[model samples]
Target: MDLQTFMKDRKKLVEDALFSYMNAVKAPEVLLESMNYSLKAGGKRLRPLLVLATLKSFGKSEELGMPVACAVEMIHTYSLVHDDLPSMDDDDFRRGKPTNHKVFGEAMAILAGDALLTHSFEVMEDLLNYDVKPIKVVTLMKELAKAAGPTGMVGGQVADMEGEGAQLSLQDLEYIHRNKTGKLLGYSIVAGAILGDATEEQISKLEQFADHLGLAFQIRDDILDIEGDAAKIGKPVGSDTLNEKVTYPSLLTMNGAKEKLEYHIKEAKRILEEIPLESDLLGQLCDLIAKRDH
Candidate 1:
């Protein structure tokens, strides 16, 4: 398949699925609108695409993974809504539009994020309709919780907040990136494998691949903040610098960060090859992570 066309098509599927889920939920009018605002904000839809692509790599049908894919995107979008709050990244813009708080006010934005986060679990339950095994549903829910909960993304967010303006060690930086950014991504990849009933060996390899891919993804984001076109990126360059946050580029010099990104990308691809599945789609995703402009 043409990788770009494949990605675009899957992205559209995720977007449509997300919109439908949000629309079906009954909520206060403004709250629903606020949630939809950020949910509708255009992104690369990378997380959900990872779910679909990983499932495809194992010869599993996308239909079985669609709910999981859309649910992850909900969780991800909620994170972004909170991440852009005045108390958090405090950014004025996201995806080229005003941040949720800017458009919806801080309280509404917080509620919107809360609604989305909780609603994701509800969406995940939709898998039951497809004759998915209860055990698999439980596993998927557990994976989602572990990836987004205190020991996962929230812990990393806290570490990141505390590390601002402090001189963070390379180890400390990786800790932040691995949990803050990497865990959910790792979950996305592994969840697909689980849904596909991939062998233990294949799941193990994908986990390693995800770990490398997650780090590479964050490092690339840091690089883009320093050197990417602001218009294309949909946010000003140097936001991390402006916030005094320690990032890959901040801890490692530009060249050092680039080298690290390259290493992770290479490692991720190597792990995929070791899995020895039909991995062209997944390999292309690795390349996209390494080289995405936005």
Candidate 2:
């Protein structure tokens, strides 16, 4: 299938899996709603789609990696919910609607983030009931934990909080984006490779590709904050400037930031070419990240 058709089809698949899995939560109604609110908030299912695309590139069925896709997305949604709390970025809107903390009370929003984080494991555990090996399931859990825990996304959040009102170098900024966003993106690619039983060399190439892709993704986000439309982006622009957060555009001029973004995309595509697999979708995704207006 073509790239657009492939993404459209896989998006539906991921959405169905997310809704089905989330709706199965047996918790209190309000908390469940808060959790579901962000899950259904309609951001691009980029991480999950990466999982599926990597699986497909390695000649594995997307269904085999569906559980991992759902698990990663839940972790991502939980992070977004927590990141929007009053003590955090203090955003009142997400995906063009009220944030979880805005619609639900702050307490419920906290619980909802907690619930999503915890329940992602339950969703992952269901893999054991399928045809997957016990060792593979264990490896997946380890990967997810390391990426979302103190050593990864949470650690990045702490660094981000501390960096506010402080002058940060480009290296310091890269460190934050690499951990906060890149770790999960890398894991999604590696998850598909593991599921498809890719060779060690193949996994390494994909990991390198993911690293560059993640950096490019963040740089584009910085650019969008300056040049993008709120309607397309689904949030008011200039938030980074408003919050006094250091960003690529703030340090590098807009032209310089675009140059950096192009460099990353070029490096990512070069690494992708060395992967020795069908990665048209991954290639298209790289272009999308560099050019996305939102």
Q: In model 1, how large is the Cα lDDT of residue 17? A: 86
Instruction: Give per-candidate clash totals.
Output: 0, 0
- TM-scores across all candidates? 0.97, 0.97
For model 2, how does the per-residue alpha-carbon lDDT over 1-294 read when each residue is reduced to its tens digit? 466688788899999999999877788888888888989996888899989999988888789888889999999999999999998988898887899999998999999999889888888887886688999999899989998999989998889899999999999999899999999999999999989888989888888999999999999999999999989999889989998999999999899999999999999999988877765888888998999987
Number of clashes in model 2?
0
Model 2 global lDDT (CA atoms, 0 to 1):
0.90
For model 2, where is the 10-residue window of minimal lDDT?
A: 1-10
Q: Please report, as a residue range, the 10-residue window in candidate 1 with the lowest summed lDDT.
A: 270-279
Which RMSD values do the candidates have, in order? 1.1, 1.1
Candidate 1: tens digits of C-alpha lDDT, residues 83-151 = 999888888988888999999899999999998899999999999998889999999999899999898
Candidate 2: residue 155 lDDT (0-100): 93
Residue 293's lDDT within candidate 1 is 93
Best by lDDT: 2
Question: What is the RMSD, in Å, between candidate 2 and the native fold over all Cα?
Answer: 1.1
